[model samples]
Target: MARQLDEQIAGRFQVGQRLRVLDVGMGQGTQALRLARAGHTVTGVEQDTTMIAAARRDLAAEPEGIRDRVRIILSDGRDTGVHFLPGSFDVVLCHGVLMYVADPDPLLAGLARMLAPGGLLSLLVRNGDALAMRPGLSGDWAGALAAFDSNSYRNRLGLDARADRLDTLTATLAAIAAPLHAWYGVRVFTDLAPDGAEPPADLDALLAAEDRAGRTDPYRGVAALLHLCGVRD
Candidate 1:
């Protein structure tokens, strides 16, 4: 569910709020377009000019109905002065962007500063806790633990990714006094499955179950990575 994620985001919006939204490291304006389509003005900050060009071209090619809703600016997320102002946006998103940054702490601090009072910070990142799930499930607990401890999982970019857990993020957010809200496991079961593996009947059921589990108690502890939606207090 892409639609589920969209709905979850849209449900957070309120009409006539003149909401300003910033997408950190926005890629091709995926979430940006969705949020803009939902009537919230969106400004996307991207570091790559090529991506910005492509996003601009794509937006221009749209049916003129959704074309001008999103603004794409080329800038680094850590210091996106193009859109960064003290307490500017109502919602700030950092989806799938944290994995690329070598140091997330400074990026997080800047993001926290950009939030307006009661503004939502939505983060989507790879689940660090799932690093050993496949090995453990395959009856290789020792190997799993080793990889987990060493942080040797193959990231989506084909490089090593150090997964951050809920505890780590919670502690980080608490340091800023940001109030935490609901979190979810996105693509938890699908990501670990083999590429092109057709969803088996049982696996389909399992995926749906995991979606709920990833949002609930106990099971969420083992989720790939948790989505932390917090408000700046």
Candidate 2:
């Protein structure tokens, strides 16, 4: 998925350009810190106090220069408009948060408003279209059958959440003036890996294979997550 984001950035911006990035629901500030380290200004917005502390702790351990490039905000993803002006960011990321939103389109539109013209909006969402794949592959016939009729499910954390279908999101993005540019599936082969499972001996090979599967047809459609990139019109 990082490769997919890098590809979008490489294709859209000049080499070595410093971008203003907004990471909404940036749990633990992983991506925000990465952008800051690359010399971009990053604003991380997260509502969870525990997650805020973890992100700040991680930031505190970074070099002074990188730390200066990052700012952490205690806010919900739906509150971007209240905190930032329109066209304030070059890139906006909302990953893993949509599933928690009962109505994601409004929040998504607000995020789009924060982007500058031609700015990139990157989203990582649960794949609604493939919700049955997990249970079907796990040999849970009942669960798989139920999933085929609904887009909501109980996640690994035992929390109930909803997913977004590609077609639905594509139309929503268009309505917000950020049409879909490219998309790829995420966790195609590794979705069922037990949490905290040890890394495979050939980690690079495994990652490469997954990455390839993510960008390929048929396989990508059945992935556990979807990475979608849209550009502001």
Best by lDDT: 2
- The lDDT for every candidate, in the order shown, is 0.73, 0.95
Model 1 stretches with alpha carbons more than 4 Å out: 1-16, 81-83, 135-143, 193-210
- TM-scores, each model vs. reference: 0.81, 0.99
Could you give candidate 1's per-residue lDDT for residues 105-212 as a string of tens digits? Answer: 778878888888877888887667676876687787886888677644666457765667777787887676566666776655555677778768797577667777
How large an RMSD does model 1 have?
Answer: 3.4
Q: How many angstroms is residue 207 displaced in model 1 relative to the true structure, after the best TM-score fit?
A: 7.8
Best by the TM-score measure: 2
**Error at 99, model 1, angstroms:** 1.8
